[model samples]
Target: MPDSTRQRRPFRREGPDLRRRELIDATLRVIASRGMDAATVRTISEEAGVTPGLIRHYFETKEDLLGAAYDQHMTTLIEMSQQAVEDASQPAVRRLARFVETTLSTPVTDPEALQLWAGFIQRVRRDEAMRRIHRTNYHSFLSCLEELISGALAARGRRPSPDDLKRLTIASNAVVDGLWLEGSALPEMLGPDELTSIALDAIGAILGLDGLNDDLRKELDK
Candidate 1:
């Protein structure tokens, strides 16, 4: 995993928020490297270099800590996408292309991320809190993608109806999710830049955006 994927820790470790975030990061690292089942209080405390009592001070139960970790994971992914598209100087098309490229590229598409996601996914069905978190994050991601799709279409002088936008958003999300899963699961199957190229092509076709594939390729290459 790249360093960019890992959450940064504060040098001064006295503040509550900083300490809590550190604990969350430690929990995520444990869940990613070892299975979630192995992330007991003792293990997480050892990983965080804190006493189990300190862990209790921050999180009342293991479930609370796990939930926080899951929230952090989802937040990090969303923040990366937002940052990629936040350059006001860039055109809408470039922003959309950057969003796809960043989502499909390293760190975000890493094996560690896949493992962490899978670990939480297995529990979402049985845990009500986990299910809620999953729903919130999933919809938030879809909403962001929909906004980007709308911008991309408008950039080309095409304004989609609400129904059209809904359908297109679902399809575009499927393209990103499908490619992300495959690429993360078996990165060696595709060479560098292949997954992003495929994603841009498929998304462009789905949205009926002619020349979008080429446009995105040029945007990413630059």
Candidate 2:
């Protein structure tokens, strides 16, 4: 059975500002564990150890709450990916690994995220706000990915065209997203650590790096 079949972690209590944040998080968890249709405000509130009215208080409506939850979920994930690139004090290979590591690891790359993503993907087809949020976050993640791939290409002296870079970005993003779903759903096979390595290796290959071990080799040789 997928590890996701079991509870990943229980939502814990937090401070007031963080309290609402926790509720939003609980929304994702509830949506993940029970599907969006079953993820009622009461259920999310219960998951957060709060009352349903609290959700209405913050969001004023179920649709509003769903939109907020979607935004928070994708934005936080984007911030983590962007952080990995912007905080680069290492070589391009290491920086690229950092991007892969930050993205394909636990917390961000988990069943809960996948479930919430699936739920949101459905909404994106008919929900305007959800579609806009999804597209914005998608571009942001893609842009960062493109930068990392471009850096890898430059490091390996590969002059991929603009179209090539765009295609590479899409492919690499698919690799990461696919690994995320697989690793989250089937931890026995696609565990976080293994997925991280697989993602890094794939990126390196597409960008024409000799292999994904360059960063690790440099560290060990130091």
Candidate 3:
């Protein structure tokens, strides 16, 4: 355990938004390294080089701070995935491949991220605020993925029903989520690049894009 006294330092006052973000980040770091039980206002204040009173000024309660942290975590994941697929220079197939690859790679595949997610996911079962955050982020992730799938299918001159698109999106999400869980939990089991390749192949098979899979694999080899 860190010495709280030594951890305390002069707090630099900032604008409300920046200070709030810093506190939320501190809360996440504490939760990830020390567990959720240790992320009280005092601990987070120490982590942020501030006082408990300052933390309270930003967050009315500990649960509010926690909810903000979880929301930022989920927002980052969604942003990265969306950015990967939004590269207009890339073909639809390549964009889809990049989305799968990015999701299974760093930032998302980090052990700390997995730890934070695991810790907050349990609270979702009992915390209404956490549950709402989880549901909103989850649906946002799915919506982005579905858009990518539809674009890729259209590029191939194939039009599918809404039901088919939903099914494909769910399956594709499962593939990425499964690989992400395994890679984050057991990094030694597979190399990062290897995990990415496997994800691309699995997603290609799901969407019946074997040719694009070959292109993606070859591109990675370059």
Question: Whose lDDT is greatest here?
Answer: 3
| Candidate lDDT values, in order | 0.85, 0.78, 0.86
Give the winner by TM-score.
3
How displaced is residue 81 in candidate 3, in Å? 2.2
Task: Give the TM-score of each candidate.
Answer: 0.90, 0.80, 0.93
| After superposition, candidate 1 runs with Cα above 4 Å error | 1-13
Go through the candidates in order and give the C-alpha RMSD of each one to the true structure. Answer: 5.2, 5.8, 1.7
Clashing pairs in 1: none
**C-alpha lDDT of candidate 2 relative to the true structure:** 0.78
Per-residue CA lDDT of model 2 for 2-107, tens digit only, reads 2234443454556667766777888888787889997787667667666667677777778877888899989987887778668566777777777788788777
Residue 64 lDDT, candidate 1, scale 0-100: 93
Models sorted by TM-score, best on top? 3, 1, 2
lDDT over C-alpha atoms for residue 12 of model 1:
55
Cα shift from native, residue 78, model 1 (Å): 1.7
